[model samples]
Target: HSLHCQHPNTNFCILTRPNTHTHTHSMVDCHILLYIFPGQGAINPALQFAKHLIRMGVKVTIVTTVFAHRRITAPIPEVLTIVAFSDGYDEGFKLGDHDAQHFASELRSHGSRAIAELITASINEEGQGHPITHLVYTMGQTWAAEVARGLHIPSTPLWIQPATVFHIYYYYFNGYGDMIRKHTTTDPSCPIEIPGLPLLLTSRDLPSLLVPSNSNSYSFALPAFKEQLEYLLDTETNPPKVLVNTFDAIEPVALRAIEKFNLIPIGPLVPPPSLDRKDYAEWLNSKPESSVVYVSFGSFVVLSKQQMEEIARGLLESRLPFMWVIRETEEIGDKLEELEQGGIVVPWCSQVDVLSHPSLGCFVSHCGWNSSLESLVSGVPMVGFPQFTDQTTNAKLIEDVWKTGVRVTPNEEGIVNGDEIKRCIEMVMGGEEFTRNAKKWKALASKAVKEGGSLDMNLKAFVDEL
Candidate 1:
């Protein structure tokens, strides 16, 4: 008997048969579907991984919001297929904190169901020659699991941040939210050690969301945050195998903590930039090694006006020629204008190209996991100024565990002044010990991604399991 399923929105159909009589057949073609999250940083890594898998002969498809699909300018690989969500794409939607949270919740509620139905229809339309063999999804969108379960396919959850953030979320799940809140706001200076985690961290080392305060508009985000945490802890029906976007050498402690869970570490997955390396080389050819400080905060971490001024002043005070990637939102008029008068402020430079530049020196960053790993791979020391999310944890790994960077302490108003910023940047760039350690990490990271490396073996194991 054959069963047919049709999509309401598109001319797509799927036909299937319930097996009764068995017959020998050759190996069936497999389709691997990746569900990408909305964030740009998240989308980049998903695209990188999809491209890599496709090059290795795995058929890959991406299901993301229509809005995101439009923002990306990079050429899509021919072997990879894109399936946009049903929500109409409009780039102009002004989403507030509450609206963003509501949208996330709605996606969790119905987004996966819509994508799954579409996949069924598309497969049927293609004459049922290939079936989806596996589904890999980003965290926070629990709906992907529904589709994977419905089709009896293995589902993997990709954690785009360091596993240390997961440890914090686990603590929150076990009724430690108040503890985290107290540490981040009331007594940020005190060191708090989490059980099974490697390093002792202070309140300021946790994500800003866990920091106690009622002033911000993120109060609406609390529920969604809690919902995501609950979903992470839920291991029964949605037993997702985990894949983290981090190298083993960068966060060994966090990696050790999640060892018992079915997890794979395959990362520093940054693709080389499209621009010619010689162009970047020509720009940096005159500079001295360990002399230039490269600055960039990840996409979403916005800096206040005061913070921007402080950072600008600090960079000027350091008296170092720097390459800073300033987002339009983070530019506080005269602060960046003034900095541009002194340093190079490119709106969006190719980050990997910048990092790999021969004359590039120190990285002054928010310590996002991606940036951190990139710095390591490039053999550059860092000056960590963590802003939010997993950045706090990543900062600790850089400053405390790796000993390749220094953390700038914010003042009473939660701001790091220009002088302190200058001091940290100068120290990381000028200190021989820091440079030596950074180069060591760079060597290790390079070896980790090579054939027979730890991450390479882990990737092989992951594909083998699938």
Candidate 2:
């Protein structure tokens, strides 16, 4: 293990003589620390994963930015401890107001040093329970692994997206980026083939971060992805195990695509139902079975005014009972009042509870991985309207690979017009095939995550390996 040094403003780096004791690969000796970015999508699964580890008698600590820590309003596990450190923005960092690259850099520098200090404290304080024997982190947090390196602690990356996105990013950084860029630059819809993936892919199907058109907007993403893969590759021995939030049965091909790393499937790390599910449960119980369409674009994406208008018009035209989660309804003008009469619109609601409701027939989504996995486990079909990041690829997987839903195509002006939205929702709702596929995937997801199942066995195996 190594020592920690303090810096100027908001640092608590402490160093002392660590207990000079030998350790074994037992669950009792294993204490894990998970570092996550300030996103609901990432935090949900990380918390769930922590609960699983805690159940197995391992100590777990969750580290995040102060701004993120302040925003967590739900109750977490009692045994689990969460620590917050500054990310240069104690309040919050707005993407519209600041540069993405600057925030990312600050996150890395501050996060790495802060995590290093925590690991140092746990090591030196003999009564602080146990030393953090392992470090597990989420995507876009490659810097956490570097701290693990300095301290000689075992580390792993918990991939929150589907393993297919991991494969695409690997190839993108490892010399195949130019081909994808060339095709995407010319025509996004043109057919292309990635070396490892069996399915025929298009430039349109790739992660928006890798697309050239989005370079100016999501400038920080591709480089961050490249840095993650490069770090894993640069490790000569003891390569950190890759943990994905998908089961093997679903993504058999992509999970095994990379020869260099062993990608472990220990998930659909979907958490149990939240505490405040009573109100939504009552609301959904009042609606008829398979009668409601659930619409939500997960946290980050800010839809264009034209796009929002189209969505409102589409929902009204479909005449289906819907529950739309519009955080900033002011952006949509007075359309909220009209829509509320036919359906429901709220700033926030529990997604898991909504998806699991019997009344929910079709999901109008941004195709974020968390939402996709939740919909899959709930047996709900989807109308995928992806906004950015790995969402397009996840949508592609949902439609083409999983066969659980249909992805929508935006019109010439890049707006998913009301007619198209209405058409997709109607098709998804009316089709028996989609429903059957959804139920089948739902059963498979349950089997993988249930007691004595693949996921349970995999988690045990992972702990043993640690």
Candidate 3:
């Protein structure tokens, strides 16, 4: 006799008939294959999203580069399976903070063909069983769309950055190259009005590549970015839907601007479970509420030796109890040595757990999308010291639009001094006006992510459409 049983959550397990068994109804279901970008700060949110979907009784599989899986130490939530493809990139070659970007570029060049082959191989492995029902990909790995097309499945693009960044690129693709170039170069002080966007943003808020000057770092990165943007715009096959990792409460204006382009906002998608560290939790819980400051610069940006020294001095000068996640590139000079006597400097930490801790009063950050969302959801205000790329834009949103943070001015060499750092930190940590504004944003952020909230409903609608 054969036995067929279904779990409370609708997960099925089948047992074959012992002998002379009668025919029974077949039991199989659709699966979701997530193709992820290998960028720093990309995997954590993607993993969280996958976990939530799996809990809803959907099967989920993540496909990514080998290097990314190894480098990012955030423990993968249970119930999610990860499939990694080899890019022939060696992890032994220590490039410090350049690892994520290097792996992404190499994956684009060599991993695309491998990813295509892997998808076909995975499908064949499942033969006559559960076929893939949906293909979700990150913007970094645009090549996944090709594989999704070959499989004839619906593909969706997930943007880990802000919606404004995508809109800026879309504008660049629609024959505004000369205007964008002119505005970027001739007028750093001038505010460039985006055609489809509701809010007017200054040139300083746009990605460095959109600016016209050849002297900035974006000048070199622009060529590759332009090629990627062009690939996303060309609609030769199945045009995938776009999704951003932001809530409407934070950027309702930007959200409205991208509505005509068919973008979906389903975010503050941070993991619900705590990071797997009991000792750390105990340590954090020992402190009082709003007593500690959390510091981290999202993976890629590195500060010069002088800049690092100045920041270290400032932290010590402020005399606040802080936890700083120093990237491998942040070398300790004399100033850091002095501060280490008073504070903690870890190479990496359980970010979500750290932010959610009652001890965490404020965040000093580079304003990366993932970090910003985490801080907002955790009710921590910010002291923005943006280094590059969309970080500048994110800083503007925090300090200007949201009124929850203060921006520090960098010196001629683009290094923020000790006094500026101290001043910003004090303002974010204890200043009455800044604290009140931070609480207001915190309440709005909480409302946006709760049950029946905008992001929750939008996510449900997005899944239904699929």
Candidate 4:
């Protein structure tokens, strides 16, 4: 089916296929339909693959929540098609406060029906008339896999985080769940061993989903994560194929850790620049090459007033020109006037564009996988101040395993103070070792995404198999 872009940002894209009399069994899978389900984070990597699939002459469609669709900061590609659906929370899912179980349940119910309708609508002669051949589901949208199973469609789960995190989740659900809970309950920072992983992970290094119930409270995401992993390990008849957003050279051990599944690495799925060439052109031009600090905590993750103050002070204390993306909700108080002395504080900006800018010297990040990979590919050193979820684990790898950055340690009050933030920023910006390591990874990442590279081959293999 060919897509007709009738209007800009419209939820439905008009698709053209053959007439009713011309439709037949041969038309079922001839269209090479690829339906993608994407969860929220920085930007949807699904869109990156959508462009690739479009170039490959595949019919691609993105089925995501209306909220996510609205939140997209850049212009949608004209070649690719997007279809938005209801997920009960059209206003957007509140991460820290929303009921995880209820969110999962609602997402499963609304999203499953929406997907079914979307697939059916495209296949029918009276509708789009293109039969879906394969479905690709991204992280946190495990219910997408379940829906595909019920429909007897071939589906692949895209692991957005590092392959090591996937290995950890598999172990958690398989047999180590109880032990991990027990150990972490006693000491949130106690070290433990997981099969296949070489490093000793303390609770501070584990994904926040694995943290047990206590004064820190319980995690609502565990159930959904468990279901996702169980579906991968148990429900599939043959070995399930998993697509990871990582390069084989970077995570060879973690990628090979699971023997039961085919984990394909086909990323740094970072998209090309979509912003106006002159949007931040002037700001970047004003700064010296490799002299500005770029700070962002991704889409979610709201810091407290105290934390915000500390970060603001830290940026000021460093006496470095910086660009910090602080969500509008947090008021900076009197520091707003002072912040103008050293930097700019906007609600958001084109992160990729900022990272790619010649002026970007260091990144003060929350270590979300997308941001981490962006920094790595852009050769920007980091000062990691992880908040929750897989961020802590990513920070651990950044500071310890990969040695691309320094992780900030909070004080006894569990707040990373301004002084500590300043110290980490200075260390990352001043040290040559971290900068050198970052540039090396950047080259390797660039190589992996090039023609016939490891990630390139992996992506081709996955697409060809379909």
Candidate 5:
């Protein structure tokens, strides 16, 4: 006799059938084994996608770092198994540390060995004895893909940004490296166009890795990103499978630009908002539809004190009901009180929940990919105030490609004044055009994830080949 437990949230079910008892109708019908390798910020979406794989009768296991294990705030699915590996930073990696480059080297060496051992252990008679057939890895951790190749296991790279950014990086390392370097070195403000992308990207619109500002602390990781692309090219016979976090209708050109790799768009991978209510629910319920502006810069990207103050003044001057998320360390002193009078301030809340709320009309964002996708799916307009990395790229996509939002331009002093923030907010919130565009993208994004959609068919084809 066997017992089955179903998770109310995710459709996947947990089965306690004996190994010898194989039934055609069981939840564990398929014998396909999937090993997933995802990095820090990318892990959350990876896990969500992995659960869907489980629902499709694929046995999935996640291999990540100890720091990432602790950082995951979402509830894990009952059928999935997660194993943590050491990245040489068991305590956690800190910014501005001298060991930045050394840390990258350590992660590559130690992580490769750890992943190799994990694969071996799973197959060995003394261990769980499951044979892993396919491996899927995310960006920057190319070493995991190398491990899979060494084991003769089929694997793919999961690109976690908009396809346009992938095309930008591909062009930079391939033939346009020197040209891009020249433009950024002499003048970052100059607009330079890439081969496939229609937009004329300024240095501000490029990834910080190619043209890092003095404040960009992670320039050491640029070589690692380059290495990832190099490894993708190393596989000769087959077009390397690149799983991108985008949809067909949104970035059709960028997704199909590279002929050498199969870029499968399988995302907007953010998990649906949980049913368990949080503290902010009541306050959000208090506001009317399309009235509140939700502001957040994400977990990373520490804003400067001066920048924070300027944003504070902007929100206050805008006079819109808002929700601002500030880190505990960031202090604005007396202004916090005045700002709270008109809106709410919290360290964190369920971002998806807030964005999906009827009260949310505008998002004042730093334009990270995860946040960008969330805003798109939620059908909320945005005021893009991009700070670093792919954020500038995402902001450009929002303002130009998608036209679902407006980007905030900083002054000559490199600070976005309160007046400028207010102007952008009014433009996004006051216009029906932005709202209509947002809803249109939201429908398209939702359609991609539904059954028999592009993402579903793509994922199924990839898994079936294994």
Candidate 6:
């Protein structure tokens, strides 16, 4: 027999449920299949969300690429099953080495077959496991919903980006593509006003995908998003329910912007403070509160040597104790050797833990949605050095809307220099305004996750449907 846990809480989803045999009624277990984006940024939040499901007595099975599954170092959370399907890249898919378009097509073809097999196998078991009753997919995972459709299970997309971005993309595909292109085609400084978004966005504030001059516009992800949104457009009676990783107080306007979508803000889905020992924790502990700079560009971004050197110069100039995560070692030079001596320089660390540390005053980041949310919830301000896709949009949110950070711009040479980095870091760290805003948002985020809070209420409502 499956686990029929009886632990109860004020929150409904946090309680465990009875199995078919335990309950005389016809109610079966609710099993959700979460198909996640393979990247570290996407995988972490999805896992956190799954943990909440398990607490609620729901069964969760995560399906991801074979390579991604192997790369995860953490012990898999108890009771949540992790399953892998090949993306035809059993080893790994390096963007620099592989073609993105071909990979997306292969993931769709192979993933669909594997999911069908997985679902079928579960059905055959007698009180062994539960068949998937609902499907939730992340970015670039629209094809999973197609499988859910064929299998007759309900599906919803978990949009990991800000709700504002989802709205921009919806507007683009539905009618505003040409007008947006016209506004962004020439100067990036041109103002492009999108309906429903309270603020007028410049091309700088837009996703690089919508900007014709930006390199990201040429990538396969744009088309993948287009396909995802287009499929949602055909529904008549029911508006597509999109689960976004943002909270109400932070994105009150954006959440209510689109009537076409039942945009559910069940997030700031940042994980709780980690208790695991970090090698740099002791050093961070020694520093004064809100005195150190934390720098990371997430897993994928590779900056030019000139830019890296400039950043190194700036951090050194700022004269703050710092922790920098430098993944791409080949492109960097000896300038970072100095960084390792006085500061902590590693390939990676527990980012959520680091950000939440009291010593962390400022975050120098790529403005990835995960990173941005983590920084905000941790009560840390930022110096945004964004690159590509949703990073630009998130940077705008950080600097303009949220008032919790500053952004750095590249000069004529297409590089953000040491001066710019130092300026932003010093500004963010020195200003009480940024820190105050960060603390304000952090408080709201905490309230949202408390029992019966906005995020908790939304997630509970969704779970109730199951």
Error of 2 at 201 (Å): 1.1
For residues 80-113, what per-residue lDDT tens digits would candidate 1 score against the true structure? 5676663432352233523755565655545666
Model 4 C-alpha lDDT per residue in residues 198-314, reported as the tens digit of each score: 899988888887875433323656666677777777777777888888887678899998888888888888876555775557877899999999889887777888988999989
lDDT (CA) per prediction: 0.70, 0.84, 0.69, 0.76, 0.79, 0.81
For residues 1-466, what per-residue lDDT tens digits would candidate 6 score against the true structure?
Answer: 1233322321101112232222223223788888887777788778878876666677788878877776666555555667666677877777678888787778888778767665665667748767788888896577888887877777888899999998899899878998898888766677888888888899989888888876652378888898888777664257788889999998888899888778998887877877998888999999999998999999888788888889888988888899999884536687767877667887888888999888999999999999999998899999999998899999999998999999998998879989889999989988999999999999998998888888768887898887
lDDT of 2 at 285: 84
Candidate 5 lDDT, tens digit per residue, 123-232? Answer: 66343445676678877677788788888776777778888988998999899999999999889889998998888988888987888454677787677678888888
Q: Which stretches of candidate 5 lie over 4 Å from their true place?
A: 1-40, 126-128, 212-215
- Order the numbered candidates by TM-score, best leading: 2, 6, 5, 4, 1, 3
Once model 5 is optimally superposed onto the true structure by TM-score, how far is the C-alpha of residue 286 displaced, in angstroms? Answer: 0.7
For lDDT, candidate 4 versus 6, the one ahead is 6
Ranking by lDDT: 2, 6, 5, 4, 1, 3
Off by over 4 Å in 3: 1-28, 72-78, 90-105, 122-128, 196-198, 212-240, 273-287
Q: How many steric clashes between backbone atoms does each model show?
A: 0, 0, 2, 0, 0, 1
Best by lDDT: 2
- What lDDT tens digits, residue by residue, belong to model 3 across residues 7-96? 232212222222222223211254677877666667877776775565445666676766666664655544455655556563522344
Best by TM-score: 2
Q: What's model 5's lDDT at 311?
A: 88
lDDT of 4 at 394: 95
Q: Which ranges of candidate 1 are over 4 A from the true structure?
A: 1-28, 86-89, 92-98, 122-128, 175-178, 181-186, 214-240, 258-260, 273-281, 335-338
All candidates: TM-score: 0.85, 0.92, 0.83, 0.89, 0.91, 0.92
TM-score of 2: 0.92
